[model samples]
Target chain A: MTAENVTAADPDTTVRAPVPSERRGPSSSAPRMLWGLVVLVAVSALALTTDGFVSVANARAILSSVSFTGILAVGTVVIMLSGNLFSLSIGTSAAVSSMLFLYLLPDVGFVLAVLLTLVAGYATFALQGAIVGRLDGNAIIVTIGAGALQVGAVTWLLPGSVQVPDGVDIGFLTRSVLGLPFPLYVFLAVALLVQCWLHYSATGRQVELVGENKAAARAAGLPTGKLVTVAFAVAGLCTAITGILLAGFNQNANLAVSGTFTFDAIAAAIVGGSSVIGGRGSAARAVLGAVIIATIANMLLLRGFGTGVRVLVEGIVVVLVVVAAQRRKRSIA
Target chain B: MTTRPGMARLARRSRRGGLPYVLLVVMLLVFVVLPVVAGQQVTSFNYYNLFQVFASLGLLSVALGLTMIAGEFDLSVLGTYAFAGLVAVKLGADDPVVGLLAALVLAALIGALQGALVAWFRLPSAAVSLGVYIALLGLTATISDSKTVPYNNLNVSDVLDRQYLEIFSLRSIIAILAVAAIAVTMTYTRFGRDVRAIGSDRRASLRIGVRVDSILVVLFVLSALLSALGGSMLALSLAAATPDPGFDPLIFALTAVLLGGVSLRGGTGTVLGIAAGILTLSLLRELLTVLATPTYVSSLATGGLLLVVAFAAAPGLNAWWLSMRRPTKRVAEPPSLSRVG
Candidate 1:
């Protein structure tokens, strides 16, 4: 549903708080901005110490690499904020979406293929949402099952990687715009849009309300189920966007297109201080989280550290952030 | 005497509602009988193959089921499996027992650490276990250097795989014994009751003095040990280990646990049911192989079965179905009166 429908339906409820004060107050933003600054300073110092880390080429590389996962992390924030925990099937969904896009690209034009792929992704995740929200199924388990089903169906139907047709030139999708990769722009745009939606839209605020306290929201006669479905549908759209960009960048798609995206996005979301307990977090924060992770990995790469080390650090960061967040919440309570 | 009636009634109802047993029988009939009816010879070898596939994954299902029964999750099982396999292959070049012990010990340590974090902080088990999962995966990759590690001794594989009584192998026998032991512990011990209670309601269990934290730690340790044992045996049997064992086993284990009627909300399910669930899966795999279907079909079947089972077990759907069957009763009782006197 659009913002207008929500406004029209709840005209009398406008006197109530539009957004949760804790989320947008200066007290919260000040600490968060300071943390961001600290990370930036640390990264800058590391860049200065490392050879070629400060180059424009390296900056572009980092942004380009973070774009797909950044978009995915933003999507994950939506589901996490909806109190569904995390979707283990995000990587699989992205893979399936990309494969569908490629499969359709040969038959249809690029635009139509992308549109169809987006619809398929949204439908798949929306069904999962309905199961979780309406059927009261466990979100984590349902998503896990959905992911496995997606992978199984994809592998069964398309035995191998799907590639762009020989005559089709979709290079423009991956091309750099104003010295930045196209995906980076898309990532920024998505982050900005979702951030605005969460802050400005009535439906988005209801989603946060449901996440914050499902029982309370239900008692208040909110459409909690529909809000959850909307959150998941929005997540699906973000993943579809990621998949489309990924396929464009690679010129091919397969089951392994973004196998690690699920964990990576989750790590980014957690590290960005998104409350895993739900009702807290922002798309912009998730974007910043993605950038922080990518920058750290880039630094590790420049330092000759292995993928194992990078992954280990990422895991450690997630644990630390989760623990820290738990402590903070406990103290607040 | 009042409590006796309620307890007896509960027991009787559980026995009557044997979903797992019924599902297992249906699955066996479909997978086994259909093949034979199609003119295929159902040999002891097929049973052996079925058990062989069941050996490792069955243990994983049990491991995951234990944690689920205790109201937690252990995504680290997959990572531990791969890591243990790699460790066993890399360390047990001379003595298999030594490598298995080392792997199990390390897994126990990892499990204990995770349990401590979850219990001490009252953290979400899924999130904590996920972090552990990623870290263990990193460890596995580091140890194996992203390559397959092969055991130098082929004799160990031969011995583990050698058929006994025309149907059972040493590994399969061990797996069954372990499952039986755990089932006995869970069904007959006070510890089992505590775990179930915790799953059903953590606060209530704590109020009743269940030692929730210590039990949680123990359960996690047991889960990790089972997974490591399974991984070690599989590696010894196959004579090789890899950095990545793929997520197929994780999905299979999860599907088996759910099929066993373990509610994701926790507090229900039997170990016997879990065993049946694993067997059902094993039989399905064997049937697909016999039918000469593509490997992807197995994935599709398992995944689809998982979704179907989950959907079927949904509380909302069950309530809706109940209401549909007894619409008059639903209309007669107000919702508030149903909960309060």
Candidate 2:
């Protein structure tokens, strides 16, 4: 029996429960130890696999990759916590943002273009959230439809062919600042801030409660609908930020690439141990998951795996991580 | 139990089944009237074009519906479709029949294994199947070198293309067969009820002694086999197997199924509803094409349609308004399923 259950049980009615509870505490610690072992082993494997996996260069690469995805994952984590299975528009949001940023770079500086894209992404996601949160609709379908519309809009709005302008290419943005790439530093800072907010803030606690049991949360007086909408809007902001970084990395914005990020972000978040059924995720895991995926992908590319094989491996890893997480959750419960 | 007047009104509406029927009628009319409103010839062409698109796409939708009914999502439809198509093309050398059978069986095996993993291990279907999709997509590319194989032999296409006796329509016949088979399984088979029961309530089904895991595994296998069959047929019809036929079909099939009023929650949809969904979406696409909408515009329309239908079908807005307008204490909790999915 759990410690909570033992305390909840009547003293006279559950005399034997104390015996189990005494044993359960030591056993419960084992799971915590196991979590530590998993992290230790994963870090070790990453260190051993690549020559400089622990080096500044590798760390920067990992951070850059994780930041964009981590930002998106944070948003998705909120939605997932709210009990939604998937958010469909993130990919299109990213694509639209990237395309818009690229198209506008000539007219505006890269930074302003990025800001504009972020606002657009936030607005679009807010719209999606409102529709999902307010109007009774399938989250998957609504976002997917919205995504498609956005992709189409981007395609029409931008000139033919899917490449970024030369002005916005990686030359200026790729340089390291303060011993770490700007993107990586940005991602870490965001992760720390979000983690603090989600852990300590009243709104964070309310969001968690909403995720855990919407009925109960509502009963306790919470703005469940608006909360869900905000979560989606946050996800949009993450997607837009990711798109900007991605545009910098590629030195070109491509809609095709943007579409893949949709599932990639989901996979990364899930692999890092985010729950699909919702109400469980952390910025740390979100970033960790993105790192793991990006590492694996980078390795596959280095190993010269065909596109098909690389995708397959990446997919398998995602499934395995999710399955493992689910099994763990079930066993613990 | 005492209830307010508004609550009583809502209860009464639930008892009346008019809403569903009205929605169906409206959708049908949209498909029929909207195209004609644009232009007459275009609408008529859409009727014929609609059949081809439906035959190709409906196969995957039905397959997805089966899995959806079992309360799981498989994102591997794209890969499986591609895998099956590639298999057919590679084996088309000796005999078209051999090639066809090979593709179907390979796909079935892959499906069964995936289904087994998902059900037996209780793995998330989306996650597991996505892995399968990626692996199969890789396998297809590695095996076929990412290029399409064209079988120029007219004999093979001729044999696979037409309905029996040249009088019947091939695509139409397949559509009928698929619908019939699914209908029979759903309406008559014990297995079908088992699936529905599990979908309706997994815990309750388990308590009632249903073999929830085994039944789901079988359902996944069956769904995969059907998807593979669809891919193979498409390959035979087109006389070429490319690496990407599967990719396009998956999303479109999903849109069709959801639009058909099959609850994504599972266990509440019908083959007829699915058919209507497919026909409606496909016809709309054809209508758009006939209207000379650009390719990008066409896709945008598809997405827009999905959003409209999603909102209209479920209406989260009402739920939000109810939650916000009513005092927090007086408002009952939103339905748990409604909030999550």
Candidate 3:
């Protein structure tokens, strides 16, 4: 939680307002600690109170199912940490790519389909990144517009759902590896890779630095614009990857295949201890956050709550998390 | 209060037939000229089709513009839109008076809650509203049980279907009146100036004694009320309420606001511009409907239009009022050289 604490205030590092907040180290850790406790209590309560929640089957279900959002959360957290705020179009791009993957699979085969979908996703985000990163436009609203554009365009071209041909095999995607689902492995691998990149690689550190203080990064001779664009590009790719993974799993990509998971991914990022203000957090933290959300959802399903009740719970949780996160940000600032 | 020059420039600017009026001209061409050129008869008979679009969507554009002018977002307002329609149609099944009050009250409370949180926390309004939107979606589902409640019990028309000049409905009248009132409030009142001030610079506004939070709170509440009212009115007009109208209107309204020439950064926009923008979109939609294009195509067109308008409108904001063809004094001459996009 206090990743910033370990980041020593090299004269270059503390280029922005070098406030006392910079020195206020261990306090931010309180939230992470509290989060740990919350997760612990909630897990025990669910295990103790709910039926069959502690079983391995249920554990596998929860873990494998939420990896879709888990992967998405990693990308969103990285984007937020890099100081781009959030992308409203995450779901849109994912849905478009999912549709694209489904459509292209029969005509071009699987590998090419996946590659083309990733390229399409990368192109979409690259444009948004260029516009926002270079022009200093409002990221949130811009994405909203782009999302609408994408949905509209896609709907215009293809208004109906398509199914993957029965002959197309997703056995490899569905198959387990070392007792875990393949999807879970991919999710974890991506998260770990991102964590390593953020903590170890020079480029990753520069991305974080650029996010923390764009002006400082510019002064320190960082390729701030390119890094920010790369951040968005990565985000776009993650969502597209998740989309194709989902198509592979579900064998269907309905025109209305929802990217509603975008909001959930963001909520997970917040709960996982990522700051919306940017330049702080890890992919593992986001994965943890995704797990927390999945646990709540699993418990609700276990309790036989209706979709309405589950949705309401998710909404309230997001609001509360945002409130607490904003409060923490203000206190530190 | 140092408002003299800004107001004076605004007054001079409004008389100059600016961008809003230019958009109005475009709207008229779309509504009248092109259709005629295409050999389509858009008589008073089908004018209601256009009016209905304006009545429902234009009101939303006006409502969104009000908040945008104050520098805030209210994403949950559309959720209230669907929710309000449900409340009014369901509660007013027998007597609309009960439904109207219930829906309005519910909208007020929802807006109040959102407004308070947004003001107190200083959180990004987008994220906060996302929460509200999702929660409200759940609430609407729970209440309606995910069913599209048919509103056949009442002669909805007796209560709200009154028409003017054989074209305008009572709902349009109410909407226009609401918009007119907002126009006056934003233009002549000190509160409007404060909103502009805060948008221009929050800290400076605070130093100048602007009640930034309160202004924002009111704007949010007002936005909710408008959204709810718009939703209810549409429901009343249609004589039914869907469980999920979703955020379609929110996006359309936003596009219209930008089309109306409201800056995304807030302030420096006029209600007249937004009104014209709303009309332009309504006519565009009407034309597409006439052409029998699919929903997605129109949506795509609208979204593309919004992006183009947003980018192109900002630099020429002050200059557009004169005429689309007339260049402003400050508009550089041919960029003094060739330029890449």
Q: TM-score of every model?
A: 0.90, 0.83, 0.87
lDDT (0-100) at residue A149 of candidate 3? Answer: 88
Better of 1 and 3 by DockQ: 1
Which one wins on lDDT? 1
DockQ-based ranking? 2, 1, 3
lDDT by residue for model 3 (A135-235), tens: 55556656777888888877767646868876888667767788888989889988998899888999889988877777667556676667878888888
- Cα lDDT tens digits, model 2, A150-249, are 8778777776444665544555455678776777776777678767877898877676666665555554558766777776777777777777777776
Better of 1 and 2 by DockQ: 2
DockQ of 1: 0.32
The interface root-mean-square deviations, each candidate in sequence, come to 7.3, 7.2, 9.6
Clashing pairs in 3: A81-A279, B17-B321, B18-B321, B19-B320, B19-B321
Best by DockQ: 2
By TM-score, highest first, what's the ranking?
1, 3, 2
lDDT of 2 by residue, B169-203 (tens): 47557766877788798878898898888776776
Clashes of each: 0, 13, 5
How well docked is model 3, in DockQ terms?
A: 0.29
The segments of candidate 1 whose C-alpha lies over 4 angstroms from its true place after superposition are A1-48, A328-333, B1-17, B320-341
Q: Give the TM-score of candidate 2.
A: 0.83
A1-333 per-residue lDDT for model 1 (tens digits) = 233434433432332233344445666667665665776797679867988788889989999999998999999999999888888889889888988988998888888999999999899989998888767777777888888788888887875899888999988879989888999999999999999998899998888888876755654667776888889988999999989988899999998886678888999888887888686899988987898889888988999988887787788778767765554232221
Please state what fraction of the native interface contacts candidate 1 reproduces. 0.44
